[model samples]
Target: MEFGIFMPNSRNGYIMAEAAPQYDPTHKHLSDIVKAGEDNGFSFALTMSSFRGHGGSTQFWEGSLESMTTMAALAKDTTFMKLIGSVQLLLVHPALAARGAMTLQDISEGRFGLNLVPGGWHPGELESLGVWPGYDYNEYRWEYATEYAQVLTELWRDGVTNFQGKHFQYDDLQLGPLPEGGRVPIVAAGASDDAIKFCAQYADYNFRLAWGGIDALNDIMTKFNAAMEDAKRVVKPYVALGVILADSDREAEEKLQRYVDTADLEAIEYMYTGAVTDTAKGGTSEILASMDQKGAMQMSTDFLVGSPSSIAEQLDEWADLDVAGYMLVLDDYVPDIKRMGAEVFPKMKNFDQTKASVA
Candidate 1:
């Protein structure tokens, strides 16, 4: 198993709490964190795209660096660690995304990954920007994504495309200087049946968030595997984890409890409400499950809050799931990157053999 750092391109990182490390994002700070990850054994860097923030005193995600541009810039900063950027389908056109992928891959010297996002989990974000589809589009998430993927592949493979689909159309559009060799590896996320099938067909890696417990995670893995079996395709799986490192498990718990006690309910409510808005499977609605069971402010069981040994023990279980990589999200990135390097990773089971290379 390898590791990746989920760049805190968003304000305040992943945790939505006033008490969480509140500060403005900076390129210098972000660079320092991923550089530390490169020094460790992290294999990749990922940045998410966010258009709006949940309303609250903290203004969660109100300000964020654009994912594509951010990754392009980070490409210049890192020697290893593949970098991926997200493209929100509703906000970005397929042809444009295809070209952008080519540019980033070249700029990164072939260390670029593309993440396709089927937008609509946060309707308000799209609506605010006037890009929200004028019609109902959530139910057709995977279908729309399939077309988007087709467009991208055609453009990348042939350097031009003449296609017509329900959601998009291209009139023999041309994009020059295709990416070297072929298409960049793609990453996508979703837990719904549609999502699973789509990943099996198109994405190279599936980004997932699993909760409920060991049994539920097993169920999800079963379903995902079944989909891949039906499609006769193999797509790697990865997870996003919120990490809190401390000298002891008790210390970590104390820190977590403090944040939970002061969690920005107003902002959390917005996320919860949006997550529950659609009945679609494996979307943000999945977040609702963990919020209901573990507490809204904190993340799923994937949230690793403990000392190096304790975190390693927890990770050992996940590594058994055959996860391709673990995307680490930290409250404070730079310092935590250093501490994780010195303590936690050295003790992790499946990842111990990965210490030699940046990837």
Candidate 2:
């Protein structure tokens, strides 16, 4: 199985200050994060894009770096590990996003991938960018993304594509000298019906947040399998995002509780209050509780926590669960990355390689 790190471009803490805090926009922590991943044998580092911060009374607003630019910067900073630019398909036209993806691929010597997000933020961001065409929200976003995927595929593989859709229209478009693979792997994320269906239809990999337990993941896998069969397409694989670090169960619990204690509850509350479109309904306490129950509490079964041997064994269990890969989130980027690489990775290397043979 492949592994990667999820880098947050937006604010990622539990507590929010009254005024927006100025973070290290240059992403000085990034080089170390990438180096740690590469040395530890990770396949890639995924960077996300968010245009604005979720502002609430208690929320902390922090500026974000653009996704494509950040990927290119990280590409120059690291050698072996691939980089993924998580782009919100609804924010920009497909042709433009494709060019951005292709440019990164060229700069990184074909070490670039795409994670297509359907968007889950306030409508004002799109309106400010002059990208919002209508207010159907979820449906409009998915339709735009569906066409976006079509355009990207056509431009990359077919040289030029002409297409029209409800939200976007384009004449002949071409993205040249595509990635060395001819097609860049595109992953899509969303749990809603439209988003899930889109991934089943076209994505090379589907991304999901670790919500419940084995049963929850199994339920999603079963649904995805059925959807692919109905569409007469084969589902590729699904990768999950989770926090996975701790040398012992006790240590894991302590670390998780620390995060919760320090967590910007205000930001989460804002997210539930429509600042984040997708997870708006759930209350902050409910969201936090769910994360805890879903393994975020004290390292659920989904996490690869504990000693190297134990973590490796945990990875094996996940492999059997049809989790082709994982994108790990770390509170302290450098230290956890170093320990994971120096201690945890060697064991995982063996575990990952032996899977195909076993299957």
Candidate 3:
């Protein structure tokens, strides 16, 4: 399986204030994290895009860098790691987004990719753009995104697209200096049924939160595969988020709990309420409840927190479930990234071959 690092642009207060005393918005700090990942054999780094943050004690989003621009910055700075910008399609014109992607692809020498996020903040954010429409916004948003990507893909392939749809229309548009091989990989994330259908139809990768162990992943894979066949497309493997495997299972649990305990309750509360305003499923309690029942939040491994050997065993289990890659979360980016690269990756790369030889 491929390993990717999730570069945290913002952190909950409890985690930020407690875990690392030196949390700065300086270029040096961020560069260290990126350098660690690149040096460590991590293939990609994922960053989320958010336009505005709801303010107050419970900060909705405290500090987030713009996605595409950040990716461009990282691309120029880093050498080996593939940089992903999760673009909120509703907030961007496809033509502009495609241009940005092509530029980043050139900057990164074909190591740039995108993730499609159709749902976003509600009236507040939309009104900020003066583009707020009436109800049925969700339906319109998804349809617009689908058409937007359709046009973007066409243009990226160096084709003059005269695409017209109720939500989006492009007249004889061609994007030049196109992306490598006339394509850029796209991933999509959501738990809603509409989101799943969108991934099945358009994405080269389906990003999902790990749930209920391998069985749960298997079920999700089954659904995605079925959808792909129905849509006359080949389904790619699921790339999971929130996987923080360490040396051992016990260590993993301890680290997760530490964050939970240290995390600013007020900040988390704010995030929960903000979700409601964002038209997202609300509350940390509710989210955790769902995760508990479904075994979603924890790493789907008895080995992740333990030593490298233990984590490798758990990874093999996940590989059997068809997980293509991981977007790993960590308490401290630099330390964990170095550890993952220095200790874990070498073991994992050869683990399967050793097991095969044994069998």
Candidate 4:
């Protein structure tokens, strides 16, 4: 399996807590993380496109960098690592997104990727930006996003699309100069069942959280593989994991406890509330509702905590699940990234950190 950082372009880096290192995302910090990933043989990095935050003490995700623009700059700066920028079809029209994605593809010389996102994880986030179609949109967003991808793909591949579909109608619209290779790799989170269907049809890569243990993951993969079978196309899966490392398991557990002890309850509640706002079943939102206190507040599951070897063992267990790679979410990015590269990388079993392409 390959590796990637779920780059912390959002504020505070997914740990909703007052005690966690609370800070705004910066260009230098984001660049440093991707650069570290490159030096360490990480194949790709993805930044979420979040326009707003769930407000509470830590102001979770309140301050954010626009993903596409940030990645365009990264495309120019980095030489090899694949940079996947996100676009919410509701916010940025596919015709327009085609332009931005095409530019980044040219800039990165074919190392750029595009990720389709919902209007926002929360409806209010898009509402605040004057783009929330409606709350009922959550139900049909899967279909809408599929159509959106169709248009974007057509425009990028053929340079013009007269495609007309339920949500979008592109009449002789054109975009140029086309992306290198005449296509851009697509990524998306296959959260709900419908979302998985969309992935089978459209995305080249799909991300699923490693929340449910192996059995649950196997079930998801079964469903995904079945859909792929029907669609006659394959979408490689990547699992996202949370990391908290130390010299020993005992120390790692203690640190995790401390973060839990000081967990930002109000912000956590806001996160939980917004997550469940979607009626879609079997997604991260539902997982949040089912979690007990620590599970919910700890943010994500499939944690790799302990010494580097211990973390490697955990990764091996996950690697057996057979994903395209793993996208790591580090509790502390800079130091954790360095430790992961220098220490843990060599310990993992059957993992490949080599890049096959650049420039």
How does each model score on lDDT? 0.81, 0.63, 0.62, 0.81
TM-score of each: 0.95, 0.80, 0.80, 0.95
How do the residues 156-190 of candidate 1 rate in per-residue lDDT, one tens digit apiece? 99988898999788798988899988787899987
Q: What TM-score would you give candidate 2 relative to the actual structure?
A: 0.80
Q: Number of clashes in every candidate structure?
A: 0, 5, 9, 0
Assess candidate 4 and give its TM-score to the true structure.
Answer: 0.95
- Stretches > 4 Å off in candidate 4: 355-359
Candidate that beats the other on TM-score, 1 or 3, i.e. the better one: 1
lDDT of 4 by residue, 108-197 (tens): 888888988875346767888899887788788888988888888898889999998888886899988888777888888856888888
Candidate 3: which stretches are off by over 4 Å? 11-26, 54-60, 121-135, 241-252, 274-304, 349-359
Which stretches of candidate 1 lie above 4 Å from their native place?
299-301, 353-359
In angstroms, how far off is 66's CA in candidate 4? 0.8
Deviation from native of the Cα of residue 28 in model 4, angstroms: 0.4
Q: Candidate 2: which stretches are off by over 4 Å? A: 13-25, 55-61, 121-124, 127-130, 133-135, 177-182, 229-235, 275-310, 347-350, 353-359
lDDT of 2: 0.63
Q: Write candidate 3's Cα lDDT for 1-359 as tens digits.
A: 56676666643312322332324244566567778776776667777775555443335345666778878888877877778888767677788888888888888888888887775433455556666664456445667778878988888886568998887777788788878899888877755556667777778777665644567668867776777788887645545544445656777767666644544444333334433443334212234333221132132211145566666556666666655667676656777778766676666643332221110
